[model samples]
Target: MSEKIKIVLAEDEPSLALIIKESLETRNFEVIVTEDGDQAYNAYISEKPELLVLDVMMPKKDGFTVAEQIRKQDKRIPIIFLTAKSQTQDVVDGFKHGGNDYLKKPFSMEELIVRIHALLNRVENNQGSDDGLTHIGGYIFDYAKQSLTYDGNTEVLTYREAEVLKHLYSTKNEMVTRSHILKEIWGDDDFFNGRSLDVFITKLRKKLDKDKNVQIINSRGYGYKLIC
Candidate 1:
């Protein structure tokens, strides 16, 4: 049998942490639960988990600090932030600190499970491939490197941006529904996540705008189509 995927989860709430640990264990994931940010970081370094799920408000260092510290050495280990802070700036700060996804507090365990699977699947697929490269217009996208190169310019992409681009590229010239993209990437299609998706789409449009042939067309209320 394949080895179970390891996870480091940091949540200060005892009851919530226990519930999450039990749920993940039932799913055959090896979960390391910590109640403080300091212990969480230590566990992360020692366990070297396949994924990280951290609560924004934790004792002794907070999720942002932990994520920043981790990102300094590893940019590819998917980190998901869990917090009650839903402000736009807070979400942006989470991304700035190297978080791959964010889940607001009072979130469903099922949603968390789906997000975990989606992120792990993305990372595994890229690692399993011999060459994680894709061509779009005049640009070369390296999935493993999370970068886009064209001409003499190379732009590094955030984890969420890379996942969005990957999905668009895979469905090039075809309409990919917004709901599908949201569920696959953010694990939800709620108003906030939908708005977040729009922000990411705009960022991607600016990044690929140098090539006229590479266009991400919006299909009104339906979805988006990447024409390359």
Candidate 2:
């Protein structure tokens, strides 16, 4: 028999955590629940869960801090952040700290389940070339490893970042619609997701800034064009 997918869930609210745990367990997921960031990190180390669902506002260390700490040790693990913070900077900070996905408060359980499955599928499939590498301007992007190396310094990218950058690189110098990217990578072109896409684009631009020749330009009201 196939083993159940294990998840580490860090939520400070007891009632919400219980509800989430029960809901996930019913869907064949084995969940380890922790109330604080410190506990969450400890659980991650001991249980070695396949995925993590973290609440941003925790007592001990905040979800972003925990994610940053974990990323130092394991960059491959998928992390999903659940939080009430919906500001643009908040969302950007979550991704910058290594979160693969972010779900704001008052979200449905169905959406959470779908996101969890999507992340697992991506991890299992391991998309990319046979060599898992690509070159853009003066940098080397290793899609398989989810990293970008420039001038001998490598920067690790989150799963979502790699996915977005890969798509942009594949269609370099050509305009790709915002709707297309939102639909393809995010599963929908809703307002929130659109904002998230913008955040990712900003991140990619910063990462590729070392090579002035490489730029992701906005075509306002249309899409983006990655010039390399």
Q: Which candidate is the best by TM-score?
A: 2
lDDT of 1 at 10: 97
Q: Which candidate number would show the highest lDDT if scored against the true structure?
A: 2
Per-residue alpha-carbon lDDT of candidate 1 for residues 15-89, written as tens digits (9 for 90 to 100): 999999999999999999999989999999999899999999999999999998997777778899999998877
Query: lDDT at 161 for candidate 2?
Result: 87
Candidate 2, residue 30: lDDT: 97
Tell me the tens digit of each residue's lDDT in model 2 across 1-228.
Answer: 138999999999999999999999999999999999999999999999999999999998999999999988877688999989878778768877888788989999999999999878866766333246788999999876778999999998876688799888879999999999877676668787788788889888999999999999998978999999
User: In model 1, which runs have C-alpha deviations exceeding 4 angstroms?
Assistant: 1-4
Q: State every prediction's TM-score relative to the real structure.
A: 0.84, 0.86
Find the 10 residues in a row with the least total lDDT in model 1: 123-132
What are the Cα lDDT values of the candidates? Answer: 0.87, 0.88
